[model samples]
Target: MFRDEKGFRPTQQIFTEVPPKYDILNRILTLNLDEGWRRKASATILEENPSRVLDLCCGTADLTMHLARSAKQSAELYGLDFSHTMLARAKEKVALFGEDRVKLIQGDAGNMPFEDEFFDAVGISFGFRNLTFENPDARLHISEVFRVLKPGGRFVVLETSQPNNRLIRAGYHFYQKYITAPIGGLLSGNRPAYDYLAHSAINYYSIPEISEVLLEAGFSKVSGQPYLLGATAIVTAIK
Candidate 1:
């Protein structure tokens, strides 16, 4: 496992320990902007009209539910996460979106349990950063994403990115470091975990950097769309 400057590892324990308030905390931390990110990612995947889709690290199945409801293609959606508690919550909400169409699995991002070329499209929102922070080589997991994608499959990613505007970038860093981390620790009682995540966002790769990484992972035609003043980005690529 790779350790950041603070020696924090983005493991399942960090996530599972705060499952009960994870959704609400996310809403507060991002000022409800996280939903828009998921919406855009799901809309992009739905545009492909894929028959089968996987929501990698689909915490609480928010994106999975959105895809099932928005996709006119009647795509079969699957959500995978390493946290058992998170998956449990996802299972409880599966029926509202038609359980037959949406399935949830507890699994690793690096070693996904699905077969190669099994999905027509794969979408992961707000989860890729954790994998990148934890793994020594992010390609080990990105390669897994490539393996699961069918020929010409699309990969949709929504994660933190460096802000382009100097003023907005400074503000974003301030909020993540001083405000978001403390608030998350107060709410979830896991200061170190949230602190590491907050730091990760401020230090994560730029949109172009992530695009290049995907290209090196054997993806062709990579594109990144920035959102929320460049603080977040939606990256799309074809296998």
Candidate 2:
């Protein structure tokens, strides 16, 4: 089953409803640091000189475009997303970026269409948290990622993390609970959607736990590093 099947219909609704305001809300909600995070994530993937890359759950192709610009023009970049609304916007942005080599695929991340060992590198940003929400086993998506990556290929994840400092963690939680949701609602006109985003970000899995999941999925090596004082991170695992 697709990881999204485990997600309630509400999850799909939120994704669909938020697309028009997604980029703007994200910029305001993250204080524009999301762009920097994408750069950092794309840089990590590009370091491998991958010719074929997949940006799984690549909403609006934000990070995918970043990788496309940094990669060789001959490289092929594919972005997969479940939400049609989101993918539509991603297509517009990809074209605007002049990334003709990038292809957008609308499908489930848990059941990728690519062949075994098809991609040299794969990455996902904030979207990874959604996959974990109802996917307690994690194997569905994890195995899919492991299966599509070439042996020695890397899967890089950029997602939220628990802040290591108690005070900062408290502040972060406060912001999630009291600030982000309201601001998101104002921008997207979807209160529940924003509320879900807040809850997911604050309660998502830890960096160490994610590394273990990758290892269990058959990755050969795993490493993770926190950024922005542990509020976010880049975790990489090699297949």
Candidate 3:
């Protein structure tokens, strides 16, 4: 497995240790807006009528399920995440859906296990920020997405973004630093992990910077739309 500078191994332990409360904490922290964001991201792909879609860094496959349900066409969805525990949960979710349309795979985002031009669309939600730090080569995950998408395919990335509204931004910062960590600690017993999530969101690229990276990855027309008072942004690019 690839190791970041911090020696994080993308292990199953991270998810297994926090699996029971992961979705609950997510809903509480986002006030249930997370589902709406996932729906919006899925809608973008569905509007394009893709037949085969790839969900990169698909923790627990929630967004993958959303895409499967939302698509107008009969779609085959593949979800990839490095964590086995997360994949297990994803498989459980797929079983509940009772459809063989969704498949989950254990794979790294930077180096996927698929041939080039194999997918009609690729989507990621709240996961790109964990790719790496310091070395921009770690950002090759975007390039890999590009390589796997067929010509004219679409890519959607939904991630947390710094709010532009002053008051909202201040409130978000406070909540992330104080409220989120404590609540996550109480629920998941992993204050440090939640703290890392907050810190990573704080340090991640801005909308324009992320757009530039998508452009660098050979996406033709990259655009970003802010959501929930700019607390998150959805970026869409066409290959």
Candidate 4:
């Protein structure tokens, strides 16, 4: 059964304070690579032209807007997040697309408000790590995604991953810890949030590791494509 209230209070607290500068900070932290990653993931998400799509944990609606822009005219897009502040920012951005086409909802990931097998495809960009890394209800969140997706639906994720190369992994961690954390914290005035983000990204699951997690969650098939020296990856899991 789903929890009555939102879980992950600490993560929620971090997010509550970052929405104002969240988008710009992300661009700065990722050197603008986050946009391209989302673009690629959005393209992959729409390849099947699913009639209904969801951008789960869709902070700031970056991926949601991408999906709306590329999806077929008849396709419906939904973005769900726990932060009202994040959803407010997302609402402003997605307004360019008609409201009827793209809907934004404030809600928890571990306990979403939707019928079973409701969506044809679900996508998360940079937010999956927030849901799963060190989260007590990680499996519940994944199960919620699985439950909401159609039998043959896809769960596409674009997120930070550990590099396979030992040297690159070390460098990546260094960049995340030293460069990303400081700069993002300084710019966003949320050092603790950035610190936590850097810590999580530095130690987040590798592509293979996360793929295994998806497989264990009952996905029939899982595949991944790494990018930028394997510092980030896009994983697609079929239900």
Provide TM-scores for the models: 0.93, 0.93, 0.90, 0.94
**Ranked by TM-score, top first:** 4, 1, 2, 3
lDDT of 3 by residue, 157-179 (tens): 89988787789888888888888
lDDT of 2 by residue, 82-175 (tens): 8888888888888965747789999988899999999999999888877876555467888888899998899999999888889998899888
The parts of candidate 1 lying over 4 Å away from their true place are 1-11
CA-lDDT, candidates in order: 0.85, 0.84, 0.81, 0.88
Error of 3 at 234 (Å): 0.8
Deviation of model 2 at 67, angstroms: 1.0
Candidate 4 Cα misplacement greater than 4 A, ranges: 1-10
Error of 1 at 108 (Å): 1.6
Backbone clash count for every predicted candidate, in the order shown: 0, 0, 0, 0
Residue pairs in clash, model 4: none
Candidates by lDDT, descending order: 4, 1, 2, 3
Over 4 Å off, model 2:
1-9, 97-99
